[model samples]
Target: MKIEILGTGCSKCKRLEERTNEAVTELGLEAEVVKVEELDQIMEYGVFKTPGLVVDGEVKESGKVPTVKAIKQLLS
Candidate 1:
């Protein structure tokens, strides 16, 4: 799975990245986690919000940060 964390390297974005890593680690899954900091790239996902989460090229979460447990559930 390709997980993309879309943000502008803000605190919330960093937290989302950390939580995403933790969730993936806990699941024992191998996935490439990418940080999309570029505005053009983020807009490509059609997300106007700062923090967004994409799984397998599909936007799963946007506009807000999700808890690790929630992210884990998404992973599952």
Candidate 2:
């Protein structure tokens, strides 16, 4: 699975990235966690908010940082 964290390196973005990594580790899933810092690339996902989470090319969360448990659910 490809997990994309969309943001311009803000604190929330970093937190989301960390939570996503934790989620993937807890789930024991091999997913590529990429940070999409480029505005053009983030816009491609149609997410206007920072700290967006994309699972397998689909937007799963946005605007706010979700908990590790929530992220695990999203990954599931």
Candidate 3:
């Protein structure tokens, strides 16, 4: 699976990225976690907010940093 975290390197964005990595590791899934810092790439996801989570090319969350538990659920 492919997971994308879209943000401009803000605190929330970093948190989301860390949590996402933790979730993936806990699940023992081989996935690519990408941080989309480019404005154009983030806009392509149609997200007007920072800290967006995209899974399999689909936007999963936006505007807030999700907890590790929540991330695990999303990955699952």
Least accurate stretch of 10 residues (summed lDDT) in model 3?
66-75
**Residue 62, candidate 2: alpha-carbon lDDT:** 93
Clashes of 1: 0
Please give each candidate's TM-score.
0.96, 0.97, 0.97
lDDT of 2 by residue, 1-76 (tens): 9999999999999999999999899999998999999999999999998989998889999999999999999999
Q: Write the per-residue lDDT of candidate 1 for residues 4-73, one digit (tens) a residue.
A: 9999999999999999999999999999999999999999989998799999999989988899999999
Instruction: Tell me how candidate 2 scores on lDDT.
Output: 0.95
Measured on C-alpha atoms, candidate 1 has an lDDT of: 0.94
Clashes by residue pair, model 2: none
Better of 1 and 2 by lDDT: 2
